[model samples]
Target: MPIAATPLRVLQVTDLHLKTQPGSRVWGVDVDAGLSAVLARIRERHPVVDFILVTGDLVGDEPDAYERVRQALEPLGAPVHCLPGNHDFPAALGQRLRDGLVRWQRHVIVGNWQFVLLDSSFPGTPSGHLAPSELGLLDTALAMHPELHAMVCLHHNPIPTDTPWLDTMTVGNGEALFAVLDRYPQVRAVVWGHIHAEFSARRGDIHLLATPATCVQFKPGTAEPQVDELPPGYRWFELHPDGRLETGVERVEPARMPASARRAPT
Candidate 1:
């Protein structure tokens, strides 16, 4: 995991529903703890990562939650860029991440790859959308980097993940998103995080990925809302100088439990 020798490396974590404790009635219990564990693992394994993408769901719309999340991530020291998730307050989160965040407004070139983040979080809803204005920004970014390989990041999955219940709150303008991608064959991949399950697919030449949540993973294609009991995880990507993108998900072991609910070691 010596990323220093690599062209460019990025780590992404999403849907971290971090809360104060395990059983707190408050929205995001233990997501910060889970993220902390992931951060520790990442630092130990890949110390040379250039940047990280925490794609959204930073604080679950609570001012205190966002505050805690901010404090937790301040030590990582990477140039972290984030977008607003459905659970986040854009204005509030934007202010906190102003220095750390990058807008989806422009095409960011890292090595030979162009990274574009999409703010697909619609206000007051659990689903996502890319407004006309936002779409225009994305279109322009892709057009500007016609020859550069691109990756678009968003909070919600643009395509269905085969789970009927989880599919209810997907990106509203998926067809439009795809249409725009079709216009730009130079785009490399589309990465998303809302599904909370590890899945991947191909749309023509474009690779679509849905990464695991940092705390809990929702069972894939299940009718019941059950947890996978897997450890918090994140994804890493190595962008070669030749525009070839190599990425995979890494599930950290020994699920980090809150102090109040530690499981007994057998």
Candidate 2:
């Protein structure tokens, strides 16, 4: 495959879990602060981020958290496309980002790649299921962009993490999801957020990647839902025009919090 004039650069920041309030803590870490630190590292290291893929859990259940998320991401100066996680309120999130710099869009094309974002969030449930509409979108998008390398993004993992408890939440209809992709040779990657850690694997010609959360990190390949002691992190991707790509996970230390600011909620 010949290289295009420019490689598409993307930063995947997921499971932000930002609280409506700045100093709120989750699992003993100040998540809002953690997310800020991750963004700082991205800005300093990757000065020219073409796009940011926010895979969901942007907040807990706060209706106002979307606005806060939008505010925090404004400094990145890149278009952000978001998908909903089980913890997110899509309608509320859409309202805040509907007409802003952080809007959630379905299909985006950069260089020789076509990005298709899908909503896999199932209301009132931790497990995910891709609705038929999403399935149709995936089918149509791949059909429409046969000449472009396609990367499909969703909030839930389509393949099991193999970490017993976490696997329970993998996309319930993952087989169905795969069936759609199996027909499209143009699909090169499947990316998601939810497991809260980095995962990289391949299925045939497709890359399966899960990015680390911008907040607390989750211990991988465990029997249960476990929080790792690692600091906050994010993933970066460099897509070449020749259907080849490079990606890596980067973690940043949390900013120093005052003693009083370090307490977890009761």
Candidate 3:
């Protein structure tokens, strides 16, 4: 196979959950400060990324909270694309985004890559599911972009999380999801949020990645609900001109008042 050539850089953020009121805390952490802190980290590391992908759960359903989150991202210097999570407000999202904002099941093609962002929010549930409309949309988009390697981003994990607790509420029609994905060999990766924990695995050629929350990460495989104290983080994907993607997570402490880490000797 001949190697394709065009570089693409993508930064993914998940589970910001910023509250509408400033200074409000989500899961014991000040969300407003957390949003700022995470953005600071992104700017420091990815000054000029090709694009930013917000995986979902931006504001914990406050509707107004998205303003704060969007404002924080304003200076990131790239096109910001988002998807909805189980905790996100679909109505608010629709209102806030521009008329041209890519709809729930649109195909965004850049260079040799096509990113398909899906909405997995179940109307009245903490968990998620892919409605028939969404599945059909995804099917059409993948078919149209068959020439480009794809990255599917959604709020829910379409694969088992193994934490029996979470596994129960994961994407309800995942097998159906995988069934569709199986038809598209050009899909190189599947990235999601919602789990809040950090995980990476592979099913055949498609790599799967889960990012840590902007405020917190859930403990992996725990029988009980738990939040990890590690600071918020993001992931960077460098898509080679030849269709191969090099990726890894970039984590930084949420900005601190006096700076938490011990300083070097003066």
Candidate 4:
């Protein structure tokens, strides 16, 4: 009998919020330091991933920081595919992250799995919206590769996170996105970032996942935005050839910080 194929290992790091200046703090946590710690853990725990997906928020509203974002991710030694979050400048990402291991790739096929990265960012606002063209891309990719299992990724949550403040920023036309996905049975999962907290749910047979930010986490189920004391982290996945997937979140202890750097909920 023939042996089964080895599962493909993939890493996802999102919501870096890196600024032009190093050591900047987001919500009292050092964003750069947090990302470095998460990357170190990734190197130790997932040293040989097939690729890395940075869902969005690579920089903190600073277009010039794309280069810094590129520098931070280069040492990982895997093809890094990135999409824009509300805080990102799309043009800058395309121009600065064009070469090397980092790229602005929308669709990727590996083994029997096809990854579709979408830009849910709407201009001049933090809320998410999928344009007609983006939906078209998904339709086209799924139609062309019916045999390949699909995992759709975006920076914004497609479902209500139950956090009232955060829900205002969820994908505005998420229903349309689901309507498209409903047509394809091969879509195994839909994953995203921007919530800064880990979320897991099931939509029929499809898996819905939201990963924590590498910088800081927001407390879930709160009326207002509140910071969670949970340490920074990333998500990992093992995609088997038969459409079976094993995934989990790994949080790392952030470097010790001065008391002044820690923020308290208002």
Which candidate has the highest lDDT of all?
4
The residue-by-residue lDDT of candidate 2 on 10-53, one tens digit each, is 99999988888887776667778888889889889999977999
- Best by the TM-score measure: 4
lDDT of 3 by residue, 162-252 (tens): 8766776778899888999999998899999888777899999999988877765566777766666667678889998667988988767
- Model 3 TM-score, 2 decimals: 0.90
Q: CA shift at 157, candidate 4, in angstroms?
A: 0.4
Per residue, candidate 4 scores C-alpha lDDT tens digits across 164-249 of 98988999999999999999999999999999999999999899999989997888998977777888899999999889888999
State the lDDT at 152 in candidate 2: 95
Overall local distance difference test of candidate 3: 0.76
The local distance difference test score of each candidate is 0.72, 0.84, 0.76, 0.89
lDDT at 228, model 4: 79
* Candidate 2 residue-wise lDDT at 203: 98
TM-score between candidate 1 and the true structure: 0.87
Collision pairs in model 4: none
- CA-only RMSD, every prediction: 5.2, 3.6, 6.2, 3.1
Stretches of candidate 4 exceeding 4 Å from the true structure: 1-4, 255-266
Ranking by TM-score: 4, 2, 3, 1
Clash pairs for candidate 2: none
What ranges in model 3 sit over 4 Å off?
Answer: 1-6, 99-105, 254-266
